[model samples]
Each structure stands twice: as C-alpha cells, then as structure tokens.
Target: MNPGVADAALEGGSAPVGPRRGRLGRPSWPLTILMIAASLTVLVPLYFTIVMAFKSPAQIGSGSGLEFPSPIVWDNFARAWEMVGFGRSLMVTALITVFSVAGAIVVCSMVAYAIARNWHRRAYKVAYIYLLSGLFVPFTVLILPLIKLTAMLGIDGPVGVTLIHIVGGIAFNSLLYIAFLRSIPLELEESARIDGATTWQVFWRVIFPLLGPMNATVGIFAFLGAWNDFLLPQMMIANPELQTLPVVQQLFQGEFNTEYNLAFASYLMAMVPTLIAFVFAQKWVMSGVMRGAIK
Candidate 1:
C-alpha cells in the first residue's frame, strides 16, 4: 500500500474541516429555558406561602411578599400551635393515618393476590370487573349513604372517620396492587405450590417479599390521603377535640380571618410529616408506577 494515499483515505480525504463549536452537539437551550420557566411558576408561589407562614400578622399585611421579612417572627409557630390545638389534632391525625394505611395495605394486597393469581377463573373475572366499575362512581354519590350507615352503627368521632377512609380506599388502592401483582411472574408462585406449600404460605413467604416497594408506595399514598381529608372528618366528628388537621385548619381560618400568618403557620406544621414521607417514598413510588406501566 502507498503510505501517503492510505493515510489520506483513512481520514476521509480531510477536506475543509469546519469550526469545532457546531460539531460538539450542544444541548438545546430552548428546552432548558422552558423547564426552568415552568419550575419557577410553581416554586415562586410555594416560596411566598412559606415566607408568609413565618411572618407576623402585621408584617404579612404590610411587607412585600417577594422580599425577606424585616424581623423574622419565629413565635408564629408557637401561637399557631395553641390557636389550632395542635397537640390534640396531631394525635387524631396520626391515628387516622396509621389505621387507614394499615387497613388499605392488608385488604388491598389480599384482594389483588386473589385476583391476579386466579385471573382465568370466571368468578374472579366478574369480581374484578365489579371492582373496576366502582372506579368511575364518584365518592360524592356514596357519602350520603355512608353517613346514614355510620349514624346507624353509632360510629362517630376519629375512629369512625378512620374506617371510612380505609373503605373509600378500596377502588384505587386495589387497582394499584392488582396491576403490580400481575407484573410478577406466576412461575415463582407455582413452584412454591409444588413444594407442598399451602396457598397462604405461597402468598406470605413467596409473593409477599416482592411486594415491599409497591406496599410502600401504596401506604404513602393512603397516608397522605387520610392525613389531608377534611369533610369526612367534619361530618363524622363535630367535637373540636376529635378533629383532624385539615378539618380544624379550616375552622382556624374561618375563626381567625385576620390572622393569615398564624393559620398558615399551623397548616404548614400539619404538612411536615407527609412531605417527609413523600421524600423518602418517591423512589419506591417511581418503581411502582413503572411496574404497573410494563406490558
């Protein structure tokens, strides 16, 4: 081979090399600009709400919303606590959240397992359809009947409200669990049966371990739902001492219309635990959502 000719051919004749900037393939500046713009739209309002939560009533009324507080009113949190009865509301809210999440996880998982494991069975097919039908039936239509039934059962106050939250969870929670269970391979389950394991053993020892991430996702969703519920608690529990966070937060706002800072300070406190849980559960939630979307 001729060395000069071979080298020229290998470099594709090296004709008129252009500027290096265009060849570098820089990322689209337009898309980055849009994303930053969209994020600011949401974050700016949230940032103002947070600053207002920490401000004194006079400062909140007079100061510019975008600017930092002249004097940070840290005492708003303490005043907000007593104003909202944070101690009692916190206990009731915690109780409702825990019980509702626990019930939803156990009940929904079992229902999902049964449906997914026996999907070919005619009975299960019918039942699954029946449950899916409830998905479109809005909860507003059912609340009237629910209130009457609760009244008949002498079920009132925080515990009664908690049960209602769990019952209302059946539609969406079961759907998520069922979709996740469907994604799991049946071969693992069938092999367990062949090893002389009972149905409960197959579920508890085999399929249950794989459900951890999905369960975390479901529990976080259920807890957030229960924690933020308002009207259900109001109708079921008229007693001030038994009220949950959102319900009492409303009452706080209505009673103290002039004190926006104090009311918001208390509301933000109620939101803290839920926000923390979501931060931790975000990874599991992404996993669960992906599992459901798989073909």
Candidate 2:
C-alpha cells in the first residue's frame, strides 16, 4: 500500500470509534465537562456531609451546608453515637455482615462449582437458569411475602435478616463465581482426583484455593450490602433493640424535623468501614471482574 493511502485508511478506519479529541491529545471539551459535572454529583454531597457532620447546630442553621465549621464540633459524633446506641448497632451489623459474607462465599461458590462442572448436563443447566432468574426479581416485590414467611418461621429478627442477605446475593454472586470458574482449567481438579482425593476433597483442596480473587470481590460486595442495608432489617427485625446501624440511625429523623449534624455524623461513621474495605480490596475486585469477563 502507498504510504499516503495507508495513513488515510488508518485514520478513516479509527474515525468511527469515538468522538474526536481536541488539540494536544486532550479529550473533547464536552466529554471532559460532562465527566466533571457527573463527578460533582458525588463530590458535592460528600463535601456537604463532611462539613455538616462537623458543624454545630447554630452553625448549621446559620449557613447552607457548604462552609466548614469555624470551630469544628466533635460533640455531634459523641451525641450521634449515644443517641443511636452505636456500639450495639455496630456489633449487630458486623455479625450480620460477617455471617452473610461467609455464607454467600461458601454456598454460592459450591453451587457455582457444581453447576459449572456439570454445565453440559440438562439438570445442572436448568438449575443454573432457575437461579439466574432471581436477578430480575426486585427486592421490593418480595418484601411483603418475606415478611409473612419470616414471621411464620419464627426468624423475624437479625437471624432472619442475615439469612435474607445471604439468600438474596446467591444469584449475582454465583454468576460471578461461575464465570470465573470457567477460566479455571479442569486439569487442576483432575490432578487432585488422581491423588485419591474425593469430590469434596478435590473442591476444598484444589478448586477453592484458586477462587481467592473472586472470593475477595464477592466478599467485599456482600459486606457492603449487609452492613449498609436498612430496609430489610427495619421491616423484618421484630425487636426494636436488634436493629442494624443504618436502621438505628433513623433516630435523627422525624416527620417534620431533622437533626442535620447528628444525621450526617451517623452516616459518615457508617460509611467509613465500607470505604476502608473497598480501598484495601479494590485491586482484587478489578482482577476478579477481568477474570470473570474473560470466559
């Protein structure tokens, strides 16, 4: 091909890929502006939350929530902690989150492993499809039915809420595990079986170890979902003393009145654990997503 023709052809071929960039290889201004605007939607609220949490009641009333407090007040956190019974709620939330994450990982991984290995069979294929159907069902639609079912089972408390979280996550978590499991070669399990390993032994000794990245990814998601959940705990937990932190934080709100400082402080506190978990495990999440996507 002629050099000039080749250059023109290459440029023309790539032209439809995306919007054109501006001078100096910068992205188009419209795209940059749109991204900035989208980012502000999150950043602005985060800024307000931090500022409001530190502000005194008088300061909160004197200005819009944008300004930093002249003298930051630690009392809001102290009051929010006491009013919400933060210690008890935190312990309950942690127990539910830990149980939910562990249960989801073990149960979903086993189910996905079974389904993935037997995918060519009719029964497993049907079972996989049946589970995947759950992804489309909205939680709101199940709430009323779940309320009745839990009451009947005598689990209308934190235990019921924990069970719901684990069960609810099976569809999505199994999907991730199944996808990642596809990328793992059957030779590994075969080698284990050749060493006189049983089916359960093969899975435990060979397959489960290899799912570390996907497990981290799933566990992080499960932790966040269980820890931050409010609706399920509020509706399902019969005893008011057993509510999770997110549900307990409702103390700061009233029909006609709100405690901005206390509410923001409580929210900030609840958000910290999630932020820490994501920060530490973010790389595993990315790697797991890429591995899952590959097969």
Candidate 3:
C-alpha cells in the first residue's frame, strides 16, 4: 500500500492499546463513576440542608421540598433569633461550653499526664477504671441518680450541666489524651527536668506546647458537645432563662405555630460555632487524630 493509504488506514482504525484491559489494570471508568456516585450520595443530605436553610417559608410551605425559594429569604435568621431567644440562649451555651471544655482539657490533661508518665499502679489503674466505667453506664440509666445527686449537691443550673459534661466526658477524653501522651518522647521531659523545671512549669511550658494539636482536637470536640448539648441542659435547668441554644432553638417549633423556616435557620445558627472552630482547628485537629491513630 502507498504511504498515504497506510496513514489513512491507521487514522480510520482505533489506536493500539497501551496496557492490560482488566478492571484493576485498565482505566476504571466504572469504578470512577461508582466513587462519584457514592460521594454525591453522602453529600446530598448536606446539600439539601444548606439549600433548605436558605429557602423561604413560602418555598418550603409550597411542598416542593426540593426547589429553590422564590424570594431567597435572608430575614428568617433574624426571625429565628427573636422567636427562639437565640441570643440569650447562645450566651448561656457559650459560657457553659467555654468553661466546660476548658475545664475538661485542663483536668483531663493533668490526669493523662500523671497516668501516662509518672505512675501506673493498681490504685491509678483502679481509679481510671472507675472513670472509664462512665462510658459503659448509659446516661439514661443515670438520669434518676443524677437528678437526686444534683439536688443533693445544689448543682442544678448551667453550672450543674457543665459539671455533668466534665464528669461524663472525663473517661474518653482522658484516655485519648493519655494514649497520645504515651507517644511523646521522654527525652524532652527528661531534659526539662534536668534543667530544673518544676512539674507545673514542665507541663505548662514544654509538654503542653507539644500537646497543642491533641489539645485542639479534644477541645473542639468538647466545645461542640457542650454547645450543642440538649438533654443535660433541658433536664437540669428548669428556668427558661437557663436554657441552652439547642433547647432554646426548640422553641421555634411548638405544639402550635411550627415555624419550619425559622427552625431551619435556628439549626444553621447552632452550627455556626462548631463550623468556626473546625475552620480554625482543622490542621491541628487532623494531625492530632492521625498521630493518635499511629500511636
């Protein structure tokens, strides 16, 4: 055949295959498609919630359920805030979250440091087991006991709720921290000790900074728990004034006058602090989790 005829034949025919053609070896169009489908499956609910949050009552009320709002109502947030007393609730929740998380981090860190480094005896082990027992004992089982205990202790308001969180959270939080602490190089602490650093100084200056990522990881989780905690606050605090954001946000939907649009907005509002905390702590948080997992 002529060169031009051969070239034309090659062009008309398919290009020669470069590699093996099995599902594992070949370009996996099916697998890629499956992964994309799975991702959308997971993200669709988040997408739906975000879109619904931005929609108007008229749009939600229309029963389309999936369509965008005509007006794109932004004032639903303000209405939600007022109807729910969201500001006051947020303040109370923030106070509780900040204090509880800080307290948990401090107390848990100290306990973890002791258990991780200094001592590992039956006494410490038994005490740790007693703390960890909280994880097995469901909060539902303890509700009555806790009610009576709180009444006896005169710890019945937001303060009571914070204390409850600290108690409830201690076991898991301290375990994670202590597990991570075991991974820290003893040489660092030893060198600090040689330099005449006191126990508190060594903890505050050296070990503490090294634990930054883990601390942030623990803190964001603790904070979000406290910020979004509904049951403890609702059960412990009878005064409407003491209600948290989650409990207060519930006010938007009553036996009557169920404000779905405002309810969605309030839900979004409740997410704001957690969102912010994640944004700021993402790097360290992820690193800490990976480090802990490795250890």
Candidate 4:
C-alpha cells in the first residue's frame, strides 16, 4: 500500500482537515442577535419597572422614563405596600403558591408514573391521552363555566383558586414528568420490589427521590403560575380583603388615574419571589429538560 494511503487508513480515514469534526462551529451572529433582542424584551421592561418603582411622583413626569430616580426614593414601595395591603396579599399569594407547587408535583408525578408504567394497558393509556388533551383547550374558554361551578360548590375563593391552579397544571407537568420517568430504568423498581418493597414503597423510596430535578422544574413552573396569576384570583376571590397580590395591586390603577411609581413598585414586589424561585431552580430545570429529551 502507498505511504499516504497507509497513513490515512491508520488515522481513521482522514489524517488532516481545516477544522476537526469535534470542534464547535463559529457562533451564528443572526441567532445571537435574535436571542439578545428576545432577552431585551424581558430586561428592558424590568429596567423600566425598577426605574419607575423608585421614581417619585415629581421625578416621573419631569423627565424621560429612562432616567434614574435622583434621590432614589424608597417611599414608592412603602406607599404601594400600604395601598395594596401587601402583607395580607403576600401571605395569600404565598400560601396559594406553596400549595399549588406541592399539589402539582405530587399529583402530576404520580399520574405520570402510573401512565408511564402502564402505558400498555388500555384504561391508563386512555386516561393519559385524555389528560394530554387538556393542553389543547384554552383556559379562557373554561373560565365562565369554572366560575359558575366554583360558585355552586361554594369554593369561589383562595381555596378554589389553588385547586384550579393545581388542576390546570396537570397536563403540562405530567408530560414533563412522564418524559423524565421514561429515562429512569424499570430495573430499579424491580430490584426494590425484589427486596420486599410494595409498589407504593418502591415509588416513594426508589423513584420519587430520583425525580428531584424534574420536581424542581415542575415546582418552579407551578410556583410562578400560581403566584403571577391575576385573572383567576381577580374573578374568583369575591371578597376584596381575600384577594391575591396581583389583584390587590389594581388599586394603583383606575379609569381616570394611574400611580405609575406605586404600581411599578407593587409589580416589582410581586415578581421578586418568582425571580428567586427561577434563579435557584434554573439548573435543575435545564437538567430535567435535557434528560427528558434524551428519552
């Protein structure tokens, strides 16, 4: 054989190249620009929110909105806090978020586990498809019926709101959970069963613990959804005193007047918890998504 051919054969068919196949390609400028633009859509509003939140009523009208507050007034937050009944509304929102997150994780995980394990069975398969079907239906289409039903059931309050959040999240959360569950080996459960563990024990001990990443992803989503929900709490919680933070924040805006500074202050406050949740859980969420996609 020729020396060149021999060298090529020994070098896995290609001995030299301009760029190695394993090396990453150059960054796509257009994609990078698009992503930056998309991110600015979020960051710009946030910037304005922080600016408006700190601006005094005088500073707000005196100059462009991009200008920072000269004195850095903290009174907007205080005034918004008082006007919106921030303490009570915060408590109500927190409770609803906590319950909604917990319920979504537990219920959706269990349902996903059952469907995934018994996918060959007709009943479970039908139920799985039915649950997924909910994803196609818009929430607004059901709001009127939901309102009437909750009223009839005498749960048209925070309790009803929390319940609806949990139920509404079932479809999407279960899809994530089921996809992640597929990546888990059935051998683990079988081993647990061989050690005298019942199906329930096998799940709670062997399976549930392994679902930490996906749980974080689902929990964060549920927390954000429940916390940021405005329409449901606004329409359902009949008593003004029992309304959620988003609903109570409406006090800063009306037909004839709007307190931009105070409204932004309240908006900033309401979004802080969600920001914290996402910041902490983002890693787990990415890992869960990657793992689920692998299967």
RMSD for each of the candidates: 11.6, 7.3, 13.0, 8.8
In terms of lDDT, the poorest run of 10 residues in model 3 is 11-20
- For candidate 4, the lDDT comes to 0.84
**What is the TM-score of each predicted model, taking all chains together?**
0.80, 0.81, 0.78, 0.80
Q: Model 4, range 200-282, lDDT digits (tens) per residue? A: 99889999999987897787678768988999999898888889988887786688655788888988998887677667866
Off by over 4 Å in 4: 1-42, 256-258, 279-281, 285-295
Model 1 poorest 10 in a row by lDDT: 10-19
lDDT string, candidate 3, 175-198, tens digits = 888876876999998899999999
Query: What value does the lDDT take at residue 107 in candidate 1?
Result: 85
Task: Point out the higher-scoring one by lDDT: 2 or 3.
Answer: 2
- Candidate 2 lDDT, 1-295, residue by residue in tens: 4757644544444333234455366558999899999999998998888888998888888897799886898998998899888889999999999999999999999999999999999999999999999999999999999999999999999999999999898998999899779879999888888889999998888999999878877887787789888899999999888889889877777785567888899989988877776678665555444443332
User: Highest TM-score, which number?
Assistant: 2
10 residues in a row with least lDDT, candidate 2: 10-19
Q: Candidate 1 — which pairs collide?
A: none
Q: Which of 1 and 2 is ahead in lDDT?
A: 2
Computed on alpha carbons, the lDDT of every model, listed in order, comes to 0.78, 0.85, 0.78, 0.84
